[model samples]
Target: MQNDWEWFNNNPEIKKLMQHTATQGYYFILYYMYYVSSASSVYAGLAFGAPIMDMILPLNETREKIPSFPTNYGIDGEKYFILLGIHGFIVNAMAMAWLWTTDAFIIMMVYHCSSLFNIVGVLLQQLNMKNCNYDEQYEKKIITEAIIVHKYAIEFAEFIEKSVTKVYGFIFMVNMIMMSITGFYAVLNFEKRKSEAIRMALFTVSQGIHLFLNTIPSQCIINSSESVFHAVYNCKWDELSIKSKNLLNIMLTRSSRPYTLTAGKFYPVNFENFGNIIKTSLSYLTVLNSMQ
Candidate 1:
């Protein structure tokens, strides 16, 4: 009736005929939409990637071992591999828990894991930058070892990226398109369409972006395939005269392979815009949190 009065006051035609029923009529739509999008399978897809792996690699192999390793990074490559296996197992177990139940406990575990990953990833990234010796020493380490290290990383990144796009991306794309049409009806029926929380509306899209962003670093580090150098490093000590080591060093030091040996083996770590993208995302999340 108030809507009818408002109509009567504002527009002479329908003002007396009908009040705007839209606002009060269609409010439930938005609430339902929020619940469906934010709480469903969309969140699960993005959470599956491993953060501990990102931090584990450099910390264990580079920081933990050779002489005086830091508490954070692994001391030696062997310890690093072990930690990698353990972290990987934990992530897998969490995944298994999700398949069985969407229990709050499971979701919390995922959230905690992702947080830990983010923290460790950032620290490992900084630690790697500090450890100049890693590169210099890797320059001395066997080419075969270097190739395996690079392969393990690249395969891991590719697998995670592919899974994300294939699974979550598809689900949310349908959800978003459907919701958009629903939104159109919603706007048409309501006199004053209360804006759906923009942050909530874009929740599915954000997960897609998050997956792409997290995968970038792993992709970047794996783009090297120095294989001939692999053979040089694989040479038996008995087969290696000191002269051979000298020759091998010269060959490997100067030689490098583009990860796939194809023209476009893109490395996210090397990408000029990588760091800025991360900062921009964190900034956006901060702004959203403040708005809430």
Candidate 2:
């Protein structure tokens, strides 16, 4: 794993990006930790303390059950309602822990992918701006190296995309669903449980930030990939020999296609898709509100 990381970080651009994103990733983890802590506290309280508390404080009837963490002991579907809410507590705690870890992994993946794309973009830009000498062999060697670098970068991005596309799709769908459901509950129950509502709101926002972090970098890569063509077009290509010009034309043609990171190939990650997710979630929330 260390060897693989070393290989990935071999590029200066990639190393710098990794360092920058590590700090951001840490912030995201911390934010998620707060949300998880707040949410799990409420869940733990309700899951374990509800039955006992119900005898005193009493639970609101309108609130959802099953969420009450009741264990039905009788065969006739009768709830024992024993204070054995430990099972619910355990399950909730485990799931929340899993989610927190998963969030960190997802954040890391996004940063890694973004860094690779950024490095590729830098390579393309450098290639376009590289000075060509009058020495034919020297110019050829430099341009050839640039081409190899560009191809290497493209292949690396493609590999990363293929390996993570399905994962990205899953994360996207799950995050959006969580956002919608959490936002709906947060807004609907603001009066009943202000702290719970606030926790849900924070969860929703964290999910949004997670999605944004992935999509924005994807959009940046897409834009950067396209920018390569412009870079090539504006370069000092007129000074090159016919052979060099032909090689550059080939590179330009290849770069024109660009690289894209998609979510299972069904959806491309971008700001536009991110907006659509938010709008769709809001629409669902609106409908749910109207029903309530």
Best by TM-score: 2
**Residue 92's C-alpha lDDT in candidate 2?**
74
Predicted candidate 2 versus true structure: per-residue lDDT over 242-277, tens digit per residue: 887898798789878767678887888888899998
> How well does candidate 2 match the true structure, expressed as C-alpha RMSD?
5.5
Candidate 1 structure quality by residue, lDDT tens digits, 126-230: 222334454434434433343343344345434444433343334334443444443343334344432223223345345334334333323323322333344
Weakest lDDT window of 10 consecutive positions for candidate 1: 62-71
lDDT, each prediction: 0.36, 0.67
Error of 1 at 8 (Å): 75
Q: Clash number for every model?
A: 14, 0
Say which candidate scores most in lDDT: 2
lDDT of model 1, residue 57: 54
